[model samples]
Target: MNHGDTSRERGRRGATAHVDTFARDHLPPPDQWPGLDLDIPTPPGQPGPPGLRHPDRLNCADELLSGPPADRPVFLTPAGPAWTYGELRARVDRIAHLLTGDLGVVPGNRVLLRGPTTPWLAACWLAVLKAGAIAVTVLAQQRPHELATLCDIARVRHALCDVRAVDDLVRAEVPGLRITTYGGDAPDDLLNRPAPEGPYPAVDTAADDVALIAFTSGTTGRPKGCMHFHRDVLAIADTFSRHVLRPRPDDVFAGSPPLGFTFGLGGLVIFPLRAGASALLLEQATPRQLLPAIAEHRVSVLFTAPTAYRTMLDALDGHDVTSLRRCVSAGENLPAATWHAWHERTGLRVINGIGATELLHIFISAADEDIRPGTTGVPVPGWHARVQDEHGDPVPDGEPGLLAVRGPVGCRYLADPRQRVYVRDGWNITGDTYVREPDGYFRYVARADDMIISAGYNIAGPEVEDALLRHPDVVEAAVVGRADRARGQVVVAYAVLKEGAARDAEALRVFMKTELAPYKCPREIVFLDALPRTATGKLQRFRLRGPAYPGGDQQ
Candidate 1:
């Protein structure tokens, strides 16, 4: 397959092939894709998901950049630098021109994106979309084999990479992939060179054209690419950002999730741009660093996981976070204890959301008024979320069941048969356990795979983790099912303590007994310096499974 056009040939008027058959060739067979549930309404009786389909052709870059508030600032760096929509649009245009003229990128081609979250990376993503190529943005931390797997899976033949991390790129061993570095030798680097001068037209792409291939963080095994269309890309911004986040032009978005994660892409980029707001990008934001950065940048909207928020709570002393108006949590269950503490200290309600890479962004989320502190909130406008039993039938309210949702966006995996497991009977069954209230709020229980069935008493790991976190001594906690000959499985908890705090597993066990039901209390409490987590800050409970605990084993 011809991956992209030749530079000289592409430069000539009407000389380009205009289509990359390689990308088109790899799309999952039509029958394998989940039937889009665009007609579903939000929690019933509300209007159905709107703008479910766009007419003929529309490039996301053109629509988002040329929309209203084009002259307002849209991007900000930690060093106080900012880019208005007009400037960012110009840069995207120039980059798009360079992509086609110098790099030979054309419509339907696949462009591999790598690097930390930076303005240049963001621009490259938009530029790829603007040039009509599918952007396959992988995590910078991906090793050689992982990178190679994704490249081959997506048929990626070109890359815009950060050369500083050369180990993986050099070792990926993907044949025929021409790599272009961002910080290459003076004149050849894309980031260092000036964008070619010209008004490059954004590709006139079909609304259903695949725009991005965001690979999921596969905790179970190798990551699978979740293909998203140009229309689905904008659908998230319109539904979640518009209906739930309600970000304004004055809001300054901040977050720790890398743009490689769809969570960050929406929170830090798409949401802000769609609302005509600016975003503050932090390359290395830890608990110690994030608080000061938030105070320094005067960030208004913060998006991160529950773990980071808890850590930030620990490090909030001497930090002024009054500039923050909204805090969005996802990637894992948001414990009510953490939410209560943050609200107690900041007087601002944290907007919790449940989203996945497959859906593009958030589906269930609530902001200010509709928020129920302990729950994951209701479905974002344009979505329908329902709890279901093992049989895929809807379960009554208050019964913990698998979470099944459908909306304008749904799972559309790239060449992966796991699509059937995720989407059934027109519903995207996100592998999460939840219980809905009569009031329409959805409470997160645990990942369906993360549940611990000890002697037939079904237990949610997040519930036990939440109980563990309430104890003042526990800084971080993860609960998992450990194999047991007697009870089939037992709940084991791994915890991290505060600085200078001594390990007291027995005291934590006793404390947990008081807060939780007898069966729900963790059978084992293990003290570790830290719980394992993904680079995106999600707790890797799978890694903690079967760990021997130091105390509370009353066998």
Candidate 2:
């Protein structure tokens, strides 16, 4: 109720009061770490321009249309040849006109996009934005039922899909919706059609207008749509680029995240365009494909998850990656060993951050100069972060608590009461457990929902996973909590060994004991050919918590 405590001391006291009274009984002490300078210059209360004005102007196509024609490539897709910025802009403009004039699409319309990471998908996304319509990019791997639910929730009337997914789209049976197909060797009738000449009127939209709707992993329940405004794109571009990436106009960006995911969108599309740079879009971001794309495109900035980075390093015996200036790892907790290995091999520290679909992008990330390996790093400019207890009170420094954030762009879920659970008193409850050091760096614990209580001692899954990853035999590992009658809940690990490595449970148990506290060590290790993952390649820990694996030991 008393939200006007602008004084730093008063705010800290107020936050502390909330935590001590409500959340302290449920959580652990924050890990002791170095402190941060609280006096660092904070950005303006609301850093970016107020509201989403001229949503039409934020489209990449608009920037391309007004910029000069150059020989430089704007986009390079594996499905087809590259296109210069000038040429890409022209195509986007023509497509935008067709959607608006011929297809009867107008400003504020919701268009569902279902496809792989192809050139056509990228063009359609930009064109939808250019037409002032909200683009909802769904993962291609989603089933028909999932697609139907998403379409209904977003009120999608038009869908742009690839031929491969047309049957699924049809099976979805979305009422009163129209579907269009693209890609393959067939000639595109839309491209050769007459170009829509002269300036089409741009829609006037505020910063708050929903420009895109990104859905989170529906692990707990149905996926919720996280609405991001046009300004949200710029917010990430400004915060991440200024403080973290610092890319130049000439820098070529490349990564493995799909175009639909925020990581890929920010790194491949928005970040590069914001800086007047270029992106080499890969339809298939396999390790083999990605490595060559980087070398062939001379990619300077690389963005991906930690697992991918580890895979790349293992496969990089003769890969030429000298052009790389920066590598960013997110979507999962980054192990310190991964950071050290990358730095040793490439002479670059992988910048680590913790972001969510709700926040639109990374809210707490470190710059190259400020990185502390294994930690998620400090809050970015225009954002405020605090580790708070269960009752929404600030936890003590070095203690783990819910990571709360408030920034220029916050969670605005469409028509969901779950918004109350995430956005409380203007702070976004990130559902992640973290510890803020005295020096300001934040170390990741586990998701509040993922913490395992064994013999009354709370353990974070990632911490154990981080320790296991350091072992020579472990290539990939997932730590999860399994139900145990004796201990309430216990830590269990699913490990995937590197090629030709023998997996011995007894030996691994010894390995973990030597590396971690006895209470934090995995009670059992199950060797698997591969860990189950979401479409985005994130390890699905929920699957491991099954009846078959009771007592944290595999049957």
Candidate 3:
């Protein structure tokens, strides 16, 4: 065989460093993929945005590690310890050797990384990409069934898991999966594996090669695996982190979302390294744990859900969180009540955003003085968004319609037919019902499935939840539509009350009537100690819409 023939054929198909082509083979057909604007040529003599441009050969892990100074701290723990860029790169090199040499892994293999947020887990992710493998990261809290489902969808072959969190992975018993445990003194431990390395060179992969597959956090049905490219990882930083969040080299980033969630990955790992800043990784990031960690680490940037921000307001008496300069909220809609309360108490405006697993990170956001309390901000730089009707036609600025967006990065599902449903007419049709304001800001209404129609009127669930949250005694609230006899569907409220607060459903209804119209009021109220949420802190409204309980009654 002629050597030129083999090399030229691979280039003709798609330039890649992957020896194993499973991920590439399973990608959606070119016709099913969303329109990526990166392939469009820039006009002559006119320059494009710096972050949107990438060379034919690229590895994102290599790019992120190249820019920062050697001795700058890149990873910080809540306890007293830090890892400089030099130290992280060294550890990553050693692990890359262990993966390719000792573990017999090859390029394009799917490596599952399961663990809590720590320096070790982050290093494994970077090493996998450096070794020319596709990373499939799942939460450490995933049970055996969930783990198996994710592994099956991604067709994972190998795993580098935390020793303490290995039980579920073992129990999942995915066929043909090889596992290497870390954070233990065993001879077979990943960190203890034998390796010979000075500096492990990153794989020379194409910019469009698949780097990771992130499964959607299931709110309704099966989770679809969203495939992201090497350049897509850097695009989020160039657009959102560089232009909107505006991270500084001296800033310390912290968050409650798990690293498995793209929100946490962008905020905690990729953005900081890309910005030459340090990030504080927490294994447990509940609101109570975050308070002390924030003061201890002197965290300047924070990311979490709207509910956590509201809960922290009650417990902020003795904490010293003055180091916080910028705050970002996503994973769920941020109510106007929570935003105003947080501003009144701390004088910091919470930056509200809307992002999806398909899009990887936040695409619509506003920062600092550009923030409008209730509306999610305009499309981020390097992206375009509009409100469109069912036929993919633009709606009036003040009308509620589906939000469609197109940018450098868009959805590419892995061998899934839902790709057609998510991407239509060159736009990623996000299933959120929204109204584009006259000033171009987008206002949240509800999920397309969450909208309620009762007695010839359309009602948005979040509007009712925001009204209920204004009540002094209502600590948490969720609104869903229930089947009714007269009306096709009626609004129902699930609420959690504060300690010593009366559980009077009628009084709460009257309070809501004052804040909203009569038809918007909840006809029934169910009290629970806490609202159900996914591991990523997203509200699970599907669980609330299940069959009514024994004592359930209309107000």
Candidate 4:
């Protein structure tokens, strides 16, 4: 292998970087992309600045890692010493050198990154982008077959992984993946390798160059990868984090999401870095661990799901959460009860937002004075949103319809025919049903497909779930439509009971009947220890399509 630069430079200038074109090969047809017609919003009353450059000229790594104080700590990890920006920069540069020089990585090469949210994992993500390669990040909990599927989708040949977590991946025998480990005893461990002497400049590539290919679990349970350009990375930080969340240099951010999730990447990595703020990462950021850590680290900004906020509400009494200034809720609907309960206890407002992997991070959200507990606030600056019926015509205020938005950032699926399903007539149809009030706040209705048609009435499961949660005995709930011979489908509910609460399904059904329309009442109720949820704490309604509790039903 030659250590020369001109050959690699020629490769970078080519239509596709390196020999790995899986990301490009899989991009949906250009005409199928969501219409990015909304102009990027300028900061209110700010001085004139640099004009928006063509996306092909932007390098997100430079945007996030370039200007912070070198000695300031950017992240804190439980596994090892925290990283200062200076130390983090050194590591990123060295890794970029190793990848391009010795490991034969070139621009656009798809590099698989697997591990918990640690400093090394964070550094590896940045390094891949700095090397002009696209990063394919996956969760640590994923089993081999899932990893195999991602590997096939990405056509990945190289992996920079944590030895502690990738045993399943090593055994999977993915067709093209070549593995390299960190934090291992092996002599070839990538983390232990020495950095090349001197400086390393990040790759200069088109702003539209694919930087990350993030895979998300859609309604079908199949992983759908969203391709984001280098410019999309900074665009998310600018529109959502800079404009809405409003972080400062001194603020400390924390989250429950794995960095593999776009929410986590934006909340726990990109946003903080963009603001010159500090971020706290954990392998396990569940409520059980987060409460104490918040007090211990003085975490001011929190990013997590509504279920986590509900869980943290139970554990916050002893832990001093006085340090938290802002808590963001997404991934699932924020039950009004959960939002009110957290505020009553913590005196801190939980910001409600709706975001998708296709569009990057939180786009519809409100913070501080703008927060309305149950409503996902107005479109963040730089976006346009409206509610439309199934026929794609605008619906009046206070009526439920599909939520569609066109903005600076929007969906671009990786060669999936479902691209047509998500983007229609130049708008991204977020698979959600929402009611926009006259005040312009968007209320969460069921998913566009989650509505249950029983007999003649169309009922939203969230409405019934909300009513049931009002009963002190119900701690958690999920309602799904179950096929029935008498009715096309009936509303069936799965609920988790507060300890020692009555398990009588009849009484619970009676309570729901009083609060909701008779047709919307749950036809059957089943009790369980806990409701099934994704790692991000989203209720997996599909898992409850037929069975209530594991096998059949638990009436």
Local distance difference test, per candidate? 0.81, 0.75, 0.88, 0.82
Tell me model 4's lDDT, rounded to 2 decimals: 0.82
List the pairs of residues colliding in candidate 4: 55-207, 55-208, 56-206, 56-207, 56-208, 57-207, 70-86
Model 1 C-alpha lDDT versus the unseen true structure:
0.81
For candidate 1, write residues 1-555 as lDDT tens digits: 121222321132122223985644555555444545444344454444556556657678777787756578788887756888878888888888888888888787889988888787898899999898999988888889989999888888889887776568879989999888885686878866766786778888877677889998866677888988787888898788877777888999988899889999999888887777889887786777889888988999999888888888877889999999989998988899999999998898999999998898889988887888789998887787899998889999999999998776767777777887887766789999999999899999999999999999999898998988898878888888877889998888889988988788788888998999999988877888777666677776766663343433334
All candidates: TM-score: 0.92, 0.88, 0.95, 0.93
What lDDT is obtained when candidate 2 is compared to the true structure?
0.75
* Candidate closest to the true structure, highest TM-score: 3
For model 1 the TM-score comes to 0.92
Candidate 2 TM-score versus the reference? 0.88
Tell me the lDDT of model 3 at 393. 95
lDDT of 3 by residue, 371-451 (tens): 998999988877778899999999999999999987778888888899989988668998999999999899999998889
Task: Rank by lDDT, highest first.
Answer: 3, 4, 1, 2
The candidate that achieves the highest lDDT relative to the unseen native structure: 3
Candidates' RMSD to native:
6.3, 8.3, 4.9, 5.6
The weakest ten consecutive residues by lDDT in model 4 span 1-10
Q: How many residue pairs clash in each candidate at the backbone level?
A: 0, 19, 0, 7
Worst 10 residues of 2 by lDDT: 14-23
